[model samples]
Target chain A: MEDVLKIGGKEIKSRFFVGTGKFPDKAVVRDVLEASAAEVVTVAVRRVDPDSSDENILDHIPERCVLMTNTSGARDAAEAVRIARLAKAAGCGDWIKIEVINDNKYLLPDNKETIKAIEILAEEGFTVLPYMNPDLVDARRMVDAGAAAVMPLGSPIGSNRGFRTEEIVRIMVDEIKVPVIVDAGIGAPSEAARCMEIGADAVLVNTALSAAADPVKMAEAFSKAVEAGRSAYLAGIPERIEEASASSPLTGFLR
Target chain B: MTLKINGKEEILEKEMTLTGLIKDKGLNGRNIVIECNLEIVPRQTWGKVDVKDGDSIEIISFTGGG
Candidate 1:
């Protein structure tokens, strides 16, 4: 709302960066994305498919959008670094989404590995957008470690839950200079919009739309919701006061 | 088969279907990117993709925080 967030000199208009997975198909993905009007789309690199290269989804998305490569499978800093390099070798090194999960059940990020990865990757000259915790200490550590921006998740990744850490997100927004893009657990468009309204530089949505019945239409809804929230935040909504203000001065008259 | 998912191995009862393999490895529905034998599984057919014996499956899931 203040001036949509910019990450690593990339002008990100929509706070919602959609993941290109979980859709029924790429054509459906494209249609849903067109509806969402998201400027950035997230793509992860895994094996290239032992069987075929005939129909590659990454080859299909709109060309103008930013395609971010995530270190999704890396277990430790070393593994993440390897994936980052692989992403570079694969020609998507300019933007890297650093995700180093150690815990299996909840799939929480190993802070130590993540910081290590950020430090290592930043030294390698890659623009790192580390997905991290809302803890201000860790967020600062990540930024200090050379992360171009802090992608703090509102909740666990793919939880499709609302901002569980609203207080921490607020703290990060108040403290960090680089863009604070709210990533993960945004269940609906309003959730994305709410984060933007709360001063988050951007928001990332994947599971919510990808698993939806009609992704493209849902994407459009998310796009408009994000915009509406941004616009509302810019406009400055009216204050809430359930109780009426006392017009008669009780104490002042004594003066 | 010499395949390991998250550093553990189990014999496959049948050919690998993207859905079953991901589920078998305990990554049923996650924010993971899969690579089999060095090839990436397309987003769409993760449900239908198949993996063979001795094939390598690498899956990366997202974590919370920057």
Candidate 2:
């Protein structure tokens, strides 16, 4: 296996993280995770049916997989912190994806509130992975605030636009001390591969997988793409030159 | 007894233990977290803790999300 993604003293063999949202059948989530060989899966916290004994999201996930609970509906730092605590108490582990979004129009996360949440959650012994808007300064701030990983959006959440902030994300990949996992706006497997080629530590995907015609096959494709991109990044592509240099010299070739 | 569960008023026959309230609500309390009067009641303590009248309780569970 290649270099695994290490977080909170645990090593994840697969760098591709899958989310458990937007699926037609919730039972298929387990199959997608297995197909993608993903070790970490993200889930949201909400009220369960007090009267219903229907299978919860936890029942579908395999025991081997790590559960990462996200603060999806939180509008501020305090809410995010509370969600994290609840998730931990629910035996969902200490991994919390802090997402503080106030503006529902674009669903863009507030970096300031995210940093605050990361600080509080990290202090509580939670592995805080904050979702930001692909800003370099904010990425640094998140890391300083004790974030386990910095997740920056590629575009908007669930937009499938694919790397709208490529340059900004690249800057984060280059500068941030912790892992820079691209969180949203990835439409295709090619886009995921591109992020890996640019040296992203990992990628979290939901909309594309859930919206695919065959989510299982798409998950496999994404797994391959992520691996290929990581390999290519390790191989190091040669820099491009403006002038075309002839491989065979004219003087050396027989006239 | 009236208990606020997830901000909704639920009238019970009488004041019951937290575990009893959870059972009455059909939750096993295994995969859910409970907060009583702004204090987190651990899963182990649910059986011992009693739900008094006018208590504010919040129960949260893991759902599908990204």
Candidate 3:
């Protein structure tokens, strides 16, 4: 049987998802996507600058990948809905990541507003994936509101603080019916592996790769780590104990 | 005619359709979504829809983000 992740009736082969941001150059985005083998890539919708004729991000993304346009600039549910509609009207797919952040100091997503947006967008037939703080109540509400996936922040966006919400995320993986994708604040491949080990269905990485010294190489590394972590989860990690247990039996020691 | 584009006021020398405005501004052939007064104007209807004075038009596109 092939190990594939199914989201919104789409069978995704790779558990790794990437974001097109903070890249040293726009040209490198293509290379990074190829290296990471991410089937779902994230992007933000913004007003076109009348002054500069910059290259469109869509041109760099391959046709095979699903474009998950995020409502990053929206400060509330109404704003998020508008952005999603604009993204869909732009001829991008219906996949959307609801990121409604009103608090700029920490850039934390408001669960109430996120839920509101999810309810509205899902009703409109968009595959809604909400990025949120790791709270079980909110996660459950999101699912009820028709979220395709629950993306709990590992830390803060672009902070690269790593898996700070590990315990709650693990609980969400166990309880939530939809896929649990760890997004944001993952600085290293090890953190991605850890998220998988805790039974997350997938992860979305951006700064970890884009801000890396070698983004392409880092993308490859994250890809491997996600795979390795997923495999370990399937393999069933041993239970932890306070008392030490010797790998070699005492009676079997060479005398 | 005066129009608000992307939150900035601009003066159009003559009345034009949404498609005409797009072409005049050199925004043609790019993947863009346009909203007139907070309502989305479908791309197919751009040619038929005429731009009126003081219309708030928002032209948006995809950008890199996480």
Candidate 4:
């Protein structure tokens, strides 16, 4: 069977979604993307600095990757819609990650606003993926609003806290019709594996890679971890028992 | 004419098209999105559209983010 993630008529081979952010050198993005083999990559739209002539981030991204432009600065749905429109007008693509976050202290996404943005953008024929707090209600609302995927945060954005909402995310994986992408707060490959093991469709990573000592190697590790996790999920992870169960069996030990 | 470009006030010596302004500001040939007065002006129309006074133009491009 072909194991592929399909979103809005697009087939993605790699389940690892990478973000281009906080790299020591912008050039390292290419290497990280190559290592991760991430078919979906996230980017932000910002005003071009008139004073400095900096290289465009698009130049570094491979053409094969689907550019998922995130509305990071939007504090509300209207602003997010504007940013999404601008991103599409920029010729990046129609894929927009509706990230409406007003709470700057914890940087948590506002579910209400994200759903609104998804409603508008998805109506506009853009493939909407909403980054939201891990809540079953909000996830369903987003899906109803035509979101291609519902991205629930594991922890705070860029906190490197690892998977803190495993139970809720697992529930979402079981309930949500769209792909449940565990985005943000995934600090290690093990966490990514855990998310997949719980049946998450995919995981989006950034800080874990950019903040790592070796981003390229870390990207490769995450790639393998996501693959392993998906394979484990497909293979059906055994149910956990509270009491110890001998793998070798009690009667086979010459009893 | 004066325009608010990227939130900065810039005084143009003469009225110019969006393409002219982009060229004058050394922003041509780049993968950028132009928003004039809160409306996205497609790249094809940049040459035909004339930037007026008090126009809030935002030249945007892709950046690193998650």
Native contacts matched by each model: 0.03, 0.85, 0.89, 0.94
lDDT (tens digit, per residue) of candidate 4 on B17-64: 989988988876477889988988989989899988999999898889
lDDT of 2 by residue, A176-217 (tens): 989999999898999999999999999999999999999999
lDDT of each: 0.75, 0.89, 0.94, 0.93
Give the TM-score of chain B in candidate 1.
0.68
Interface RMSD of each: 9.1, 1.0, 0.8, 0.8
DockQ of 1: 0.06
For candidate 4 chain A, the 10 contiguous residues with the lowest summed lDDT are A246-255
For candidate 2, the TM-score of chain A alone relative to the native chain A: 0.95
**What DockQ do the predictions score, one after another?**
0.06, 0.82, 0.88, 0.90
Error of 2 at B42 (Å): 0.8
Better of 3 and 4 by lDDT: 3
Candidate 4 stretches with Cα past 4 Å from truth are: A249-255
Indicate whether candidate 2 or candidate 4 has the larger DockQ. Answer: 4
The candidate maximizing lDDT is: 3
Give the TM-score of each candidate: 0.74, 0.95, 0.98, 0.97
TM-score of chain B of each: 0.68, 0.89, 0.92, 0.90
Which residue runs does candidate 3 get wrong by more than 4 Å? none
Which one wins by lDDT: 1 or 4? 4
Model 2 alpha-carbon drift over 4 Å, by segment: A51-54, A243-255
Q: After superposition, how far is residue A129 of candidate 1 from its true place, in Å?
A: 0.7
lDDT of 4 by residue, A1-255 (tens): 899999999999999999998887899999999999999999999999868766778888998999999999999999999999999888888999999988989999999999988889999999999999999998999999999999999999999999999999999999998999999999999999999999999999999999999999999999999999999999999998899877775675664
Docking class of 4: high
